[model samples]
Target: MGDNNSAQYVGIDEVPSPRAVGINKVSLLPLVFLIFYEVSGGPFGVEDSVKAAGPLLALLGFLVFPFIWSVPEALITAEMGTMFPENGGYVVWVSSALGPYWGFQQGWMKWLSGVIDNALYPVLFLDYLKSGIPDLADGFPRIAAVLVLTAVLTYMNYRGMTIVGWVAVLLGVFSILPFVVMGLVSIPKLEPSRWMVVDLHDVDWNLYLNTLFWNLNYWDSISTLAGEVHNPKKTLPKALLYALIMVVLGYFLPLLAGTGAVPLQRDLWSDGYFSDIAKILGGVWLRWWVQAAAAMSNMGMFVAEMSSDSFQLLGMAERGMLPEFFAKRSRYGTPLVGILFSASGVLLLSWMSFQEIVAAENFLYCFGMILEFIAFIQLRMKHPAASRPYKIPLGTAGSILMCIPPTALICVVLALSSFKVFVVSMIAVIIGLVLQPCLKHIEKKRYMKFSTSSDLPDIDHITNEGTLLG
Candidate 1:
């Protein structure tokens, strides 16, 4: 994987000067909120952490898991994203470090995992609304609601990333404001002791870890849009740092307030339980506000995820990993085909139970992330002198050490998966393994047009050789 021959393919620095002129690039504030929605869109689903473990572990998980997972991932993204500064994000990183074949695998796995994750948002949005609109609970109305919601969000993405980025900023502010208010109101009712409750033997490690993993992960998704940001080299790293602080506090402070203020009713701490906590602390008005925030949060997450997933496909296509048609952008500069495919996946997967959706997506995401970590380390070792607009302060040994904790955490998450999720995720992996070769054959046969963008710089000067990394 560290072979020098692959280094000759291309690097972002070699690209021609002056990006496409007419494109409207996302600025810093919008990019921060976009990353915000991509990761934690207000702690809507974090109640499950308290439900699984007690208050203390739940609180600690948000605080601690970032060091284990989020920080490493964010740091890698900052360095490599500036290094590659393209739409493919991690796919570009893996392809550069590993090979085009493995890069294609990265793209497929991450895209599929993203689609499965996106599927959950529409269901979650409706789940929040069903309390007010009982008709959405089941039957024809429920299915229709999924379709309409998916269509609307898909259109928002289709309009363009600039609009989507701005919308995320708006939605993020709305989603988070209630929690800030909740924290203020809860200050009066605060019982500091409630935050300390914990029982090791009583913990459900799977649910607790899954909840934390789902909420804290996805730091790399924003890298998929590095090509869309203005002055990505400077903006990407700054945005990530800001978003990291926002997301960690977003989850932790709300949990601190919710747990400290309310009496511990562990069983009642399921999906939409925060609204209940709001009702207790403030009144029905606060409860309604929280519910509305949750619903909008889901919308923000859907668009942010769809943007990442679709642009990834466009990025892959531009790198000549997929057919040229996938590289075609709409008049609005959105990835039209990628958006359609992602929206369809969401519609098809919306029927899954909430637990099933979370488990299945987490399973697939683990595989994608493993490939990413390998690519990150391999690049650090092989291209130590490569121009990185934003370099992590770690040396080669430190980089490897940084990855070990998250890699171990990935193993734990994979081990905890149910038999059914394991089988399903494996099938998805196998399909990606086969699909890359099939696409290669089609490209050779001229069954579909495949071409790399002419604007990308060629890097045939670098030379080193070895077999792919294990």
Candidate 2:
């Protein structure tokens, strides 16, 4: 942490209100789909859960893991998101409970995880299509395709959040519809015993846990966009409710249909296996549709994630945790600088393999979440009387209890990381540690402007004297 005495507090008068930015606010339906795309994207990438752990454990993981992990994270998000209701999202939550120094670290780790998570999409998009466009399997065509895809989707994000939300709605329908048809048709062929088949001794625990965690995680990502949603206090919670049900069904139903309809060949299960399952159950036409839907789903996830990450940078800048340039917005009311920064990071890291990306991201994500959980319990204890438009129905001890299981899961994820991933993620963490002080030094030298937004609600008042601000 930085020197608490040296920390500069910017009064509210110096910054502009978020409403004055002229961006279109997201409504309930769009927000739900955005969260959908952010969190699951209709099970497009959940095939590995079945592959690693078998149909039974994969299905059971989807069934039971959400209650342990997703629900708790989403609940905390709904409560804290509304209480702060700014672009900074979880960063604001951590800052209020901890300090500006830790808040910046949370933002850095989450933003990196988000970008690493996003790099998988363009590659996945191509993976779904490579069978048809054989040239894209490798060579200049594949690299160029990833770059072009990133640019096009980045532009969609640059256009605005409302557009991104509606696009998610459309992409979501197209993506899930084929699976719906597959499930319907497969009902006649699904073997009841297939869902119960599992070999515990043979399970690839690492892959199984990673796939389950990756798909169900990111529910809190939407919190970063709280300022972009319409009537965030009410809309945010309702959207999380609707999105949670949609995301779980999106995974469980497809896993049930695919595993049961087809013969059990665990070796055949990998990324893009769902389309093959569609082919067997519904024929070539269904396979093609599933592939197209999977591709579109990747695109949806890319835009949704890019939005979260870019807005997070903007939120940090607004809170005086980042340089003023990151706070700049375009005429469309989107964060131009932050978008460029996030998009650039996506391109730079796009070459990493899918599993590598997943492992690296999960590691960073676990770190950020540890901070978030601690911040959640701390805020509840330290500010019991603070304004909370959508408080979690839990007392201080209850909140801490709610966080325990997920916190344990986080430790499991961290412990499972490979040495390469552990090293890379630690390097990223060190950069955040050093960067914060460098930024503070820059601020002290008068090289940049930074200020807290007047329009933001004070979730807790943390002063230099280590007391809550009035």
Candidate 3:
């Protein structure tokens, strides 16, 4: 541990240099769109918020939920990600502050949560298309659609982050443009009173909170790709800030137009309701555009999420948390084994209902976030003078206070889960706990190779002067 009295800290100049030639690093614009896809794929799934609560509560949730969750998580990620500046991301943070055992647990829960989250996109993509092609509503046709879509998107991820990043930029623009036009066209028909409709007693607290949490969370998913980013210390924080603004507006403005332009028929506000709203406000042309946009948006979300999940596995492997095979990269600099594992997980979980998927993933995510908050606070208290290229601007006490609201929100989300989801998520957690020791035993027996990368800095050896010791 470093000396707390040390006034000196490591400078940005000491951070790792950029990767050698032949690998293209992600820059600011692509990084922002990547984060946008990671968190909110352009309000495609947010219509459920209005269905669960009224427009007023849904609007307030998007506005206030950020302060309670997104901001805190993003700030912690910015500071912790820049400090470590490597692939393992939060896993390294937890291992450095707590221990490797807990770090592995964090990796398992988070990666599982991410895979489960990725499964939702193909389901969402089909939901938009089924309206136009009624045959895709169920049966083997939907299953085949999911398979084909997942395969295509997985291939895109395998191509490389730079390609995925630019694709996200194009998809984001296409996905968001319809909503912008819809908002402009709906102005003549806008009903201000529609925005204020709410019935407190009738709200589905479970669905409402879950929907809000799902859309606004995952700001930290970008951290897993910090190593692939160009100048992450400066770029990560800036991308997160711009993405936050884009995401909030993306959800809120479309929601405002949809709710205020159409009548209050809560039952009608489901997954693809935005397309219907476009048709009602403008015409079939606008609706078709919205539908196509939603379809492509899910594609954007799938590739972005796959990149984060797969790279996280590679990151964990580099830190020796998993077997060495996981660290292997494809010719395009993508995580070969990790992408297959993540894509397979997505295929397995694709059959679950949308609500079930959201709840189960959210439950698992809550557990991982609890560990992250503990790690953040522990590092702040134990290594007060450590170098942080993008600090949160909070002291120890202030940091603890900052984490309180989000932690409380996590508790609420976990408590509201269905008993079935609770049991399933707990079983997954238990597997992680057991799997860690099993891997360790295998490593001891030389059953599979497990080695930390030589290039990573030693987390346990901070000098008294506050620099990382070689």
Candidate 4:
């Protein structure tokens, strides 16, 4: 069993130069909002759940899916994340349990999924604002908007995770405030039976599931930045608990208010539909507030997602999976090179249309999560006494049973992916497989520096888990 009491610090003396120092750790409040944005980011993007499956299933999804999927995933994350309380997050867990090869694959798939997922926010931010500023509808202006927004947010990430964490706190409050107002204002117009509406035959199951899954499933993303968290053993678990409640309420209140107050119009319930619901329920002032909140929430999501994606690369590099250049940090102790790489990917992939990006990211994300699930269960079995700071209160059999529903949900999500999404996602996976060996070859030939941190925790399994760090 690994000891939970050991403090987390990268042994960069054994690692290489440009050593990270004066690390800015994320504290409780900020960590909660970071997880909040990582997972829900308010209900700005969840309107499609109602559109696809009607109000009944959408409501039920936000209500029920959390227990089956979110809770289990969050529980596993709190356990595994604290178990390996380093920036490498799940990469470390997979490597310790499965091997470095699969760990790199998890990192690759997740980092790529995160970048692809991030591409949507800047575009959506503009979409919410474009109504008031029609010039942003398309052309050079929109492109430039995307670039500027990406740069500013990326720079904020480069500043430090602590700053990003606080920013998320502010943005989270701003994003949810209007919805709170909308929900309260909407009470007089509520039609309780409207929540019962469901068109089983007409439901677009894929869209509903995808929207629900996309909004709810990124609870594990925060694990990537666990190293920067203050007292993560205590902070991580509590933050997740608060974030889960905030996220569920964030989605449900607005959704309940929107569906019950407004007349049902399946076709009209798209991405920015909540802003319209605000207008209908309240007035132009409330509508504008919702739009502004939506835009800011997108920013919150972008910064939060970028922070995780970039740090995962640094984590991988510290494991000697990538060139040491990736492990370089800015003066603020942020992953400088990794941030550039992630930002570039976000820019390159931003050209993808919204639905296409969502479907593709979701497909790749599901693959990474499947690996994570396997890693979680395998560790519990192999290292039964491993000092998990936040163990899910379940024995080996109970743990397996708990994973069953979410793993089944993952299968359903993968099966439902569009052919185009499946093809594109598979290509991304192939790239990761090929990229791994190519990195090894580069390291073998001394073309680039690569070294593992000695401070990393050891998880000596009975099967002799081969060398994870090069």
Among all candidates shown, the one with the greatest TM-score:
3
Residue by residue across 1-470, what tens digits does model 4's lDDT show? Answer: 12234222221222222344566678999999999989879998888898899999999999999999999999989988877777889888898889999999999999999999999998789878887799998999999999999999999998988789999999998998998899899999999999999879998889988898899989999999888887777889898999999999988888999999999998999878888888899999998999999889999999999999999999988888888888888889999999999999999998888888889999999899889989988987777656566777788899889999988988998999999999999999999999999989988999989998766656773223222221
lDDT of each: 0.88, 0.87, 0.90, 0.86
Top lDDT model: 3
Q: How many Å off is the CA of 438 in candidate 3?
A: 0.1
lDDT for position 278 in model 4: 88
TM-score of 1: 0.94
Q: What's the C-alpha lDDT at position 32 in model 1?
A: 94
| TM-score of predicted structure 4 | 0.94
Better of 3 and 4 by TM-score: 3
TM-score against native, each model: 0.94, 0.94, 0.96, 0.94
Model 1 spans > 4 angstroms off: 1-19, 459-470
Clash count for each candidate, listed in order shown: 4, 2, 0, 0
TM-score of 2: 0.94
**How do the residues 45-164 of candidate 1 rate in per-residue lDDT, one tens digit apiece?**
898999999999999999999999999999888887887788889998888888999999989988998999998898788777787788988999999888998999999999998999
Across residues 324-390, which tens digit of lDDT does each residue of candidate 2 receive?
A: 8888888888999999999999999988888999999999999999999998898777765555667
Tell how far residue 186 is off in model 3, in angstroms. Answer: 0.6
Which of the two candidates, 3 or 4, achieves a greater lDDT against the reference? 3
